[model samples]
Target: MDRINYQHLYYFWMVAKQGSVTAACEILHLAQPTVSGQLAVFEQAVGAKLLRREGRKLVLTDTGRAVFHYAEEIFALGREMAHMLKGRTTERGVRLNIGVSDAMPKLIAYRLMAPVLKMSEPAQIHCVEDKTERLLTEIGLHSIDMMLSDVPATPAAGTRIFNHFLGESVVAVFAAPTLAARYRDDFPRCLNGAPFLLPTTNTALRRSLDQWFDSQQISPVIQAEVEDSALLKTFGAAGAGLFFSPYAVSSEIQRQYGTQMMGLAEGVFERFYAITAQRRLKHPLVAAILENAQQGLFDLLDKPAAAD
Candidate 1:
């Protein structure tokens, strides 16, 4: 038997995963004929059939499934090895992995990253967005290098790299103009009985909102409960129900679609922070990323309208 070609094995793994020769060809950026020939050669060298046509699709044979699992492990290790080597070769170069809470605004996140990618390509950045709790956990476990989030309920065991105040943005219960007119001079009172669209019960924002409502003895008629703040904003924008959200969203939605922001009078705000592992703060690339994040926040959020 001829020595198995690693490149052909790589192609076979991709084809098996994608379940189509065309898809594998596109992903590997090779001509269809070249990929097909490589697969045939690979099968001959391996001494077993790997894939068979089933109807219009390619199905992996029993042996193919076995090989694919090993191939995945091999390729994953190779990629990690390459990343580590690249990190060691450049002074300011590192692969920085950041995790962010979904509660953070997407526009702000994108804007914050634009300058970093533009100025220097020293570090490769991978950003993952999840809930605050999960993101903090990732940062703590060393799966992620840093996090930008609303402060967690308990302090995450890490050095606080920097804290930035986004300032007090109003959280208002907003309803349709028709509903507002129906309640008229007593609209604020109507919010007590009106159906509310709220975040999940466990979130810090939800907890704060619950405390405020409890103090006022106002029980909101919660029609829909969501974990995603963006979705809540969508439902609110569609006039599905009254929603409690930050002024940033109110301003954001009003700018895009015609809407109104009802004053909460409650005076609540969300604050954010950037955190990194204590030991990692001294890493050159990590320090650079943190500094950039702090400066970017001011430029993106606090700038004058003309500057924006």
Candidate 2:
């Protein structure tokens, strides 16, 4: 029922940054007990313990780290404001932080994010590429605005994150001209014993690809299993092996990587989701992305083949 005491929070932030009350007092030009007293008040006000003594230094508790992160953001905003008023900041666009899962194709990720660039006032996009689990952790910590991933966030994690279904598209295989021409005729059948670049066994797409292969009684030679989808495309483009990607960005992949599309994989689809920390999808740029994907962007993808 009381307003936040910014003075107390500031002292706590300083101590967290300097790693000790003594060091923070030296910087703030305050007495050591005064800094320590403010941190104690801050902890009491927040109803959470922020730090613990480890030898002569202070180590953050789990809640302390969370608070520290917010404190960093708050001070960062303050610095940005100071720069803006002085005309020292060059960036004026809205800032959007995106976390991209390692399993998601880079081309698809770009297409999904392209709309943000086309806005009336384009946003400054910051993308962090990481595993889904780590990205989800970032989402829970409020470090990222939203995440683009191949699959929806499962509710079993209890992270309170919501998944906004962007849309789904079947998988398409790609290879260099020579390899594409070699496998074009045989198509899916040619994949058997053929050199292939695939996602690691841990990814949902890889599991789906495996199930589809078994259903067709085909076993392809997996030349390499990678966690990074972009690297998979790189290997495929170099003629190391054939690779699979969402049909949604098939043309972009071929254009960017100089690869040729074989065709769509029958029964294997890559569903896309925009996972957000908020319950409702509210970001304007994110809304634009979802709108574009559901519109003409994925029209050809809705069918069974890649658009020429």
Candidate 3:
């Protein structure tokens, strides 16, 4: 029923983290008696029993555990504030939230992001995979910092969000060993009546492939209409059917899935775009990704994102 003391709360937090008053005292540069007394006062002030000793170890009571959880967040935010005021990031890792469209292959996404992890100050990236529409909504809501999408955001997606073309790659068809040998030699011709795992009509890649299939007059025996890119790869790897991914990661796809590359989908192109709320890209992580993509991440595949 009195004002809580932050100093007492801090001491208790330190003791809870360190597991012993002596260790907490060493870190806090306070006497053992002073740290113990502060923790006792903190419990009294909060009207709850906080700590107890079990054997040689100090442990928190049930209520103490709950309170300590909140205390951890409180002190972490305090440190964050101090760091922000000093124009330096906290000791905790920096975060980069990236939204990826389900239409984009996970392999392509991973390769595009490798440079960020290799940087001197690599960030902790939270990668979310969903449809382009949903990811665009998250970017607009500021829930997602940026998005990697196969389809560029349409004019109706919103004027505030701008699309930076990352790069483009022709689609590479891959199949499990059983199907690989059968289709290796006569590619475009063997593709006719081939067991193909196609993307759903909702994806831009599917739409383009449909146009190409029609033009080439090659009708694959559609075995499955998959929505998830990774699932498509898994199915393809399991000998269910042939699947297509960006040619840029042909080797990666073959390596990870233990699948064999059949051949490139010559005329079918898969382009990547980074959709953002900022017209002028500014986030350092985002800048690093774009810079790396331009430098040569997709060099073997095809044209750069900015070329259109």
User: Which number leads on TM-score?
Assistant: 2
Error of 1 at 284 (Å): 6.9
Badly placed stretches (over 4 Å) of model 2 are: 11-41, 49-62, 87-90, 300-308
Q: In model 2, what lDDT does residue 82 have?
A: 91
lDDT of 2: 0.84
TM-score of 2: 0.81
Residue pairs clashing, model 3: 165-305
> How many residue pairs clash in model 1?
0
Q: Which ten residues in a row have the lowest lDDT in candidate 1?
A: 160-169
Full-model lDDT for every candidate: 0.67, 0.84, 0.83
For model 1, the stretches where C-alpha displacement exceeds 4 angstroms are 1-96, 105-125, 153-168, 175-187, 282-308
lDDT string, candidate 2, 27-134, tens digits = 999998888788888899899999999999999887887788778767777888999899895554667778999998777788789888878884788899999998
Clash pairs, model 1 backbone = none
CA displacement after TM-score superposition, residue 152 of candidate 2 (Å): 1.1
lDDT string, candidate 1, 1-308, tens digits = 65668998999999999999999999999999999999999998999999999987899776786677568657866877787788744334455677777776454455445555655556567798898776665555555677766564355344543343433344655656655444435546656777778878866677888887787777888889887666776777677777766554455555653446565637455555566665556655556655666555543453324535
Candidate 3 segments exceeding 4 Å error: 1-91, 300-308
Q: Higher-TM-score candidate among 2 and 3?
A: 2
Candidate number of the best lDDT: 2
lDDT of 3 by residue, 1-308 (tens): 55768888888888889899988889989888888877877888888898899887799876777677567657867888999999995656556779999888788888788888887874678888988887887776565678998888998999899988888888878899989998787667778888999999989899999898888788889999999999998899899998888878777788899998777778888888888887336878888889888876677544423533
